[model samples]
Target: MRDRPEAAPGAAPAGVAGKKSGNWKDLRARVLSAAVLVPCVALCVWAGGLLYGALIVLAMAGMAMEWARLFGFGLETRRGQLCLAWAACVGGTALAGHWGGALLVMVAAVVLGPALWAGQVAIGCAGLSLLWLRYMSEPGAGVVLFLVACVALSDTGAYMTGRVFGGPKLAPRISPAKTWSGSIGGMCCAVLGGMLIAVMLPGALPGAVWRGALFGGLVAIAAQIGDLGESALKRACNVKDSGTILPGHGGLLDRFDGLLVAAPMAALLSLGAAGGIAFWYVGLH
Candidate 1:
């Protein structure tokens, strides 16, 4: 090292070593996070019957708890009632085996009635519950998977697009990270994901690709709204992350916020549209 140039007076060897150690630590953390996330994701994807349903139920329960925490509702008080109401709704849908007019009526009555009578918390819980029920009662595995895929794709696209092509912020107050370019990119990705899912299905693509694209675009918008809604709650509570249940991911609620909104809308659309895009496409068709 040609007598090894004298180390800078302020920059000790320890500092350089510390920096390398910090990098290794960060790398280890990321690797560990992926190690856990990958297996869990694989399990959910491969096991899509009762196991998947159970997972969904657990996820909804966890999300409900997180929501209650975010809103400052005591778990012993309002949360119990909320869970009960949600259970009832899910039970009703499962029993009926059809999410048509009856399902909508039940959800509207429960959510609006409670909002009008009990309070905002009641309404919020009911709304979330309805979304959960819709997610649970979706007809086929494929449609449910498709909806999830769209959300994932949208999120991924939005993040990448926003990072690479910075633009006007979508909502500076609610979520500074969100951008108009990201929103458009997310919508595009969602549409592409939906079309790809449709093509993969067994039968002829029921709804036109354009229709699926429109639905996906709408879902992307709704997903962002949902994300912002959750962010608002987090800001209100003065919490950085929801529960820190996941290593790198915040919490179950953090992960599923978009899905919570998108799933129900997709379910509703599937039920209404004539195209074989319904959740029950597998069973009904």
Candidate 2:
């Protein structure tokens, strides 16, 4: 048998080098896409009204299309048309401030596609909740921006720490790349980021250090759950990403999975609070 070629002294193995190179390239692409997407999203959130509603509609449409693709349905298929119609109905109802109607449409859509119905419902509800949250008279865009920043920080922290301090996998079956160290790092970053954004924003967010930390931690955990759930779905589908619509981000679903879960969670929490989401954020209730 022929002998395998050996690496030179002080040089890394071919596989390790290749993996690192790929990671760096992927990271660059992610940064570039984020730089463009983040500002647009922020602008919409700040603008509210028609601008924000349009953004949500576009996002819902994109996610619905990608979700259909996940089940092997092409854009020309009947299933794809149903998916688009469902998304339009949901978006239109939610845009008109009829959340109940949007929810009913979501439930009806689930019966049409049972394979990944749960995720579909969750994403739709999240889109509606975001619409509601932004229209809130209190806190308003400040809270939305803060939430986005914290999630982004959590994701960044996890990716960075996981690479720097490789450790035991968090869930080998669902997502082998995630580690406990990375999760912990993400949590810490989320807390810090949340507090920082709250302070920077012109509002009474948190009103206390502990409150901010708690809120941030909850958001981070929810975000992680969302990320893991999406991973599991992709694993079941035997695919790596939902789509290739966004470079480095895979697809709209892939990019906003965490936000999808986190938004509803935040909205529910706010509604349950006595004063509202803004009050809860500020520890007033």
- TM-score: which candidate is best? 2
User: Lowest lDDT 10-mer window, candidate 2?
Assistant: 1-10
Give me candidate 2's TM-score against the actual structure.
0.89
- TM-score for each prediction? 0.66, 0.89
Q: Which stretches of model 2 miss by more than 4 angstroms?
A: 1-14, 277-279
Residue 112 error for model 2, in Å?
1.0
Q: Which candidate has the highest lDDT of all?
A: 2
For candidate 2, the per-residue lDDT at 46 reads 94
The 10-residue segment with the lowest total lDDT in model 1: 1-10
TM-score of 1: 0.66
Q: Candidate 1, 8: how far from true, in Å? A: 38
**lDDT by residue for model 2 (1-285), tens:** 000111122344357666565544567777789899999999999988899888988888788888888788768998877776788788889788787888888888766658646645876888887887888635778778867776777887887787667588787677766788888888899999877665666755446466667778888888888888877777777777788877777888877888878888888777765565552354355
lDDT of 1: 0.55
Candidate 1 per-residue lDDT, tens place, 193-222, comes to 877766665663555465557666777776
> Could you tell me how far off, in angstroms, the CA of residue 123 lies in candidate 1 after the best superposition?
11
CA RMSD of each candidate after superposition: 10.2, 6.6
